[model samples]
Target: MSGPACVIRSDQAGICLFVRLTPKASRNAIGDVVANANGQMQLRVSVTAVPENGKANQVLIKLLAKAAKCPKSSVRIASGQTDRNKTLLIDGNPEELMAQISQLSGRTDT
Candidate 1:
């Protein structure tokens, strides 16, 4: 499979965000935009929660929801539930969500 095509993208369902999660981090926060070996961009996310029983995933959703100014219910993992890399689907206006994420990540490619 290919690396993440984009860090964030507008989707019919809302917005799709590619992220690399750092569980058991010192703190819960969103970092800068970064590229992988395949030159795919993804947001950096870190959380103090452990990577077990979906704890880290839950924290990730909450962190992103707050960053995007959206409700936690509006955010869900579209893929990579059991991996450090994840694709999140935030339910909202695609343009608005993309803009928010772009601002958050300091990347306007979206």
Candidate 2:
């Protein structure tokens, strides 16, 4: 599939990651960047943790931290906590984080 426009962006705080989280999946993984029905791009993430009592969300944070090579405390769910789609804020050097994200998603354009 063709890549979406952009799934990660830098702001005053740090890098903002758009994500579509799949809880209770067979395995935990970070998938490609995909566009939503409205054409907004988001990273695809799947975790085996069930979506209850913020369990899946916590797992998502840990997964992202490992993938991004950052501390788990640096990752936070900025929005969409109760939904499949979520916005994650990673605290660190935006450039470095963006580079890692691009490499992980296999998109050079971003």
Candidate 3:
């Protein structure tokens, strides 16, 4: 996958992403990486759905699957399903996918 927030790891299975989600935002979009109070970086993502009944999570998965150029089934909520901070498992080539996502995260400094 990647590291430092937008992505947590790049492994043979897939990429692991830590996302700080904002539900019911004005629109659905993926923003930049931001540090939490603990100084841990996370990707800032917003969705229009309320964070109930896993709707927001579903939306996030759909969005991410599209963004990562993978099937929706390939994106899974590895953890933090009921919380704003979520972990995602994205299936595919980690190196290639991370490169694409790095651009989406606006990770020029990296």
Candidate 4:
């Protein structure tokens, strides 16, 4: 009941983001929010790290930290560590971090 947002949410701690990660993609980037088959919208993120040995998750966290304008250590996989769909918690000013994550969801430069 704490995480799992369609895009991002402001919490007492910081911000929560729902992400759908794609490993070994053409490139690493943050994409817009897209709806899945179940009609749940998730932010799209891609990394080049192979999905073996939890490397992809680490890459994702770094990328997200950069995109969210937060320190790398501020990002953490709150849930779905082994799954493409994950919840990343960013530790920072909730308002500022949410703005950054919103820019991610509203991206049109893909």
- Using lDDT, give the best candidate's number: 2
Q: What is the C-alpha lDDT of each candidate?
A: 0.89, 0.90, 0.84, 0.81
Q: Which should have the higher lDDT, number 1 or number 3?
A: 1
Higher-scoring candidate on lDDT, 2 or 3: 2
Candidate 1 similarity to native, TM-score: 0.92
Compared with the true structure, what per-residue lDDT tens digits does model 4 show for residues 1-110?
A: 22332567666889778889999998999887887777666899989999999999999988988877778999999999889888788898887787777777784321
Worst 10 residues of 3 by lDDT: 1-10
In model 3, state the lDDT of residue 77. Answer: 92
Candidate 2 on 1-110: residue-level lDDT in tens? 22345798886667989999999999999999889998989899999999999999999999999999999999999999999999899999988888898888887875
lDDT of 1 by residue, 1-110 (tens): 12356798777879889999999999998999888777878899999999999999999999999999999999999999999888899999988898898889887665
Kindly report which residue stretches of model 4 are placed more than 4 angstroms away from their true locations once superposed.
1-5, 107-110
lDDT score for residue 21 of model 4: 97
TM-score-based ranking: 2, 1, 3, 4
Candidate 2 lDDT for residue 93: 92
lDDT of 2: 0.90
Assess the local accuracy of residue 84 in candidate 4 as a C-alpha lDDT between 0 and 100. 88
Predicted candidate 3 versus true structure: per-residue lDDT over 40-87, tens digit per residue: 778899999998999999999998889888999989999998998888
What lDDT is reached at residue 32 by model 2?
Answer: 90
Q: What's each prediction's clash count? A: 0, 0, 1, 0
Q: After TM-score superposition, what is the CA distance of residue 31 in candidate 3 from its true location, in Å?
A: 0.4
For candidate 3, what is the lDDT? 0.84
Preferred candidate (lDDT higher): 2 or 4: 2
